[model samples]
Target: MYRISVDSSRCQGHARCMAFAPEAFDFDDEGYAFVPDGMAETAELSESIRRAEANCPERAVKIEEA
Candidate 1:
């Protein structure tokens, strides 16, 4: 398993992450990408998730082994 996170401090809400994997991310009214509280399986390690990580022009995505 993997633990995935978005550094809100670094994210500029370009929405690329959501474009790559909408299933794994949510946007605030202000349009910040974050892992919602109580999110069940958004961290599942998959190609799409990795694509989202790479898609972030801000490079805000973080992934680590869980």
Candidate 2:
């Protein structure tokens, strides 16, 4: 499975993640980057998600295999 995580402390509401991959990311009321619940897939990784992960200014987006 592919899992995505955003460290709340590190998130600065840049929205780059959401902008890159709206289907994989979103914002909270405070505008922090967050991965919507149950979003990880057992399928392959997506380009948007990869770009989002790589371009996060805070390096907050984390991708892990589990």
Best by lDDT: 2
User: Each model's C-alpha lDDT?
Assistant: 0.81, 0.86
List candidate 2 segments past 4 Å from native.
Answer: none
Give the range where candidate 2 is weakest over 10 consecutive residues by summed lDDT: 36-45
Error of 1 at 60 (Å): 0.3
- Candidate 2 residue 32 Cα shift, in angstroms, is 0.4
lDDT of 1 by residue, 1-66 (tens): 667888989999988988888878898899899866654244457787889988899899888777
- Per-candidate TM vs. native? 0.83, 0.90
Deviation in Å, model 1, residue 17 alpha carbon: 0.4
How much lDDT does candidate 2 score? Answer: 0.86
Candidate 2, residues 17-58: lDDT per residue as tens digits?
988999998788887978878776536789999999999999
Where does candidate 1 stray beyond 4 Å? 38-44
